[model samples]
Target: MLNRIETYYDAVPRSSARAEEFGPLTLFVQEGQGWPYYARPALGHEGDVPVAAVEKVRARQRELGVPEAFEWVAETTPGLRAAVEATGLTVHEHPLMVLEGEPLPVPEPEGFTVRLVGADDAALDTAVAAPFAAFDAPVAPGTSARVADRITAGLTRLAAALDATGSAHAAGQHQPVGTVTEVVGVGTVPAARRQGLGLAVTAALVADARAHGTELVFLTASDADVARLYGRLGFRTIATALIAEA
Candidate 1:
């Protein structure tokens, strides 16, 4: 199962770059093209093996516009940590949690409902772009605009992919309080925060994934507080992925 977990992510790669398989080993370029992110490897298989593997992936990541990446060393396999460190890549430790057993409590807002998002739903489209509305902070105009553009573009692309893969959903009336796409983006309007809207939309998506026969649903959240909400819905941390500028 551990081995399969790595392969599952390798299969997706977050980008369009092809994943290469070499016996029990696999390599690929990460998508969304950025830094301080992971270049994952399965547990065990240490020493010269991962060194050679990283060399191969490093070249591939470079070709895909990434100069640096980290490997996710499972707590169960700390030996792989030493191997990764020896390969000249800095390593960090983080917990990997998983929620099993019964389903979590799925709460909905007083007057809203969770349902599938149509491609033409303006509320869903606006909620999808809500994250970008926070782009302008302590940063300058161009900085926020560029980041916001990337985020909007990424969400648009993801919405298209989810529709293609059959997993886009929306919540609320003509104007939604939140939106969620697969195991990806989940957000609500400022006025609607803490109203259980995010959890409701997320639960709907999880139900969709389970109905489709997917055993696991995962996501990476930079904010620990928001992650706690997901934790309540049976999403375990698994890993903390850090991102840095390229």
Candidate 2:
């Protein structure tokens, strides 16, 4: 399962980025304007990674003007967290979850509809930008416009929970590699929390993945508490996902 997850990780960035090797680390460089991909332990490379190797990867990331970020499965690369932290980077741990049971039914908020967002959808901007705001990232100018291109290319699929006024209050996306898909960036606006808008968006993405022939779905929750929320959708923690940023 770890190998399969690593393959999915390696493939998700290929549609928009190219991989560069730095020892056991692979830096995924964005080929055009879009969110920058981060560095990760190369597929199949496991065990203790040296701090020097991590330092080299960060140096290259700085040179390329990309985020000095790293993500890896804790069990797959147990020593990577220490090596990354030795470089003065801060690391965060998340629940690495996979869908192992049926998605429990979740109801949408009142007057809200959840569905996939199309390339030409007029609500694309709001849908795409919702996650950024939900995650507390400043919605910089034109930061999410490439979502349209991504949708058109079938590289990703976005789903949103929209109000009767036709505005998105929650959004998420699933990037697929064959029958396996990874759900990412699913969130609801601060004003919409506790109303099940975020849960509805996630359920929609999970359903869409199955409709498109996806056989596996997984994601990393921000924390243990949040993992319990995703548990409502039948996702269970299988490992700890470690992320480091300099």
Candidate 3:
């Protein structure tokens, strides 16, 4: 079972990258999206390029008209940070936490029941898409429809992939009150908030995890409310990550 949830920083770039070159280092670029991510050793290894190389990547991103945000691991060297700073980047800090205790046995709520979802289930898609709606950003042109389609498509693909790999799990029967996938991302809907529904969903996921021999539950927390919620469910902060956005 996965221990810590590998973060958005580690995978987002890689996920976005359509083409990559790897040698003693890795350079990943999402040409259409204008996102560029490069990585190399910190100890001045021969294959590793200087901090200027990263700045060059950022420059390429700028030239591509991408939003000027750079996401990277905190383990990046001070030299790299200084170079990025000189080029005008601001750092944003956040912590990642993992739940360590045995999974809580999910109990049925009044008027609701928890159960696993089938491979064809659509509630999982709706469950994951609801959070994006919570963000009040004006829907970009075509984004309102596209986001839902994207979420649905992504969740469908994810469900199929997990089913093939035996990684999918479902809870909250019929209407699917809750769910948890093998991959790191999990959430309850906006309509499901405050009624302890989030906890109920999470507990359902945890129960499935425990039955599957998972030793830990890992998740990243951004909001203090979610952080406190996770804490109440036995999650503890594991590490802090600093992101530099230009």
Candidate 4:
């Protein structure tokens, strides 16, 4: 699974329109959107990173007009975190998790119904707002349109939990969560917490992924408590991730 995750990480940059190769490292520049989309170092294989690799990465980020950030999976390339930190970049750690199991039923809590949503403007708005509200971050301009494009491209599957009045209460998505299907963006409104809406939306997407022939699923937990919540659905930590930024 670790090997597969490494391969997935390597392929992400290649999927972008603006990807440049630097030996084992790939730089993904998504017009300065942010981490994951911004300029970052992702290893294609385990090997000694050239002493000048860090300089080259920063140079490319400059050329692309994005901040120099390196998201490295330590399990994929041992010692990579230390190498990145040596370049004076701050590093943050996160749990890398994966799920593999037969489909498990997720009972929808009363007053909520989970279903797949299309790329319509209203649906997209609700889906995008859920995450922003949950994270306490202001919604960036053009986020909805960008996500709508991805959805139109058939690269994303969104699921939402609606109440009796058909109002969105919780939402999530399953897009190629990295080479493997992953449940991401699971969020519930403050008024909807402790009602199993998160589980409902997540399980709905998991079932959708399975129906589409995806076997292995993966996701990253924001913290240990969130990891424990996902554990209830059979996800387990398979590795750790390091996000280094200048």
Give the runs in model 1 whose Cα sits over 4 Å from its true position.
Answer: 20-27, 30-38, 42-56, 71-73, 83-95, 131-182, 188-192, 220-227, 235-246
Residue 148 of model 2, lDDT score: 80
lDDT: worst 10-residue window of model 2 = 138-147
TM-scores across all candidates? Answer: 0.57, 0.96, 0.58, 0.86
Q: Write the residue-wise lDDT of candidate 4 on 50-160 in tens digits.
A: 647777887878776677887767767765666677778888887888885864566778877788878774566877777667767777787777677777876778888
TM-score for predicted model 4 compared with the true structure: 0.86
- TM-score of predicted model 1? 0.57
Candidate 1: which pairs clash? 14-31, 15-31, 35-244, 97-238
lDDT (Cα, tens digit) per residue for candidate 2, span 100-200: 85688987778889999999998898898899889898776665667887788887899998888879999999988899999999988898888888888
RMSD of each candidate relative to the true structure = 8.7, 1.3, 8.3, 2.7
lDDT of each: 0.47, 0.88, 0.45, 0.73
Clashing pairs in 2: none
Q: In candidate 4, list every pair of residues with a backbone clash.
A: none
Against the true structure, candidate 2 reaches a TM-score of 0.96
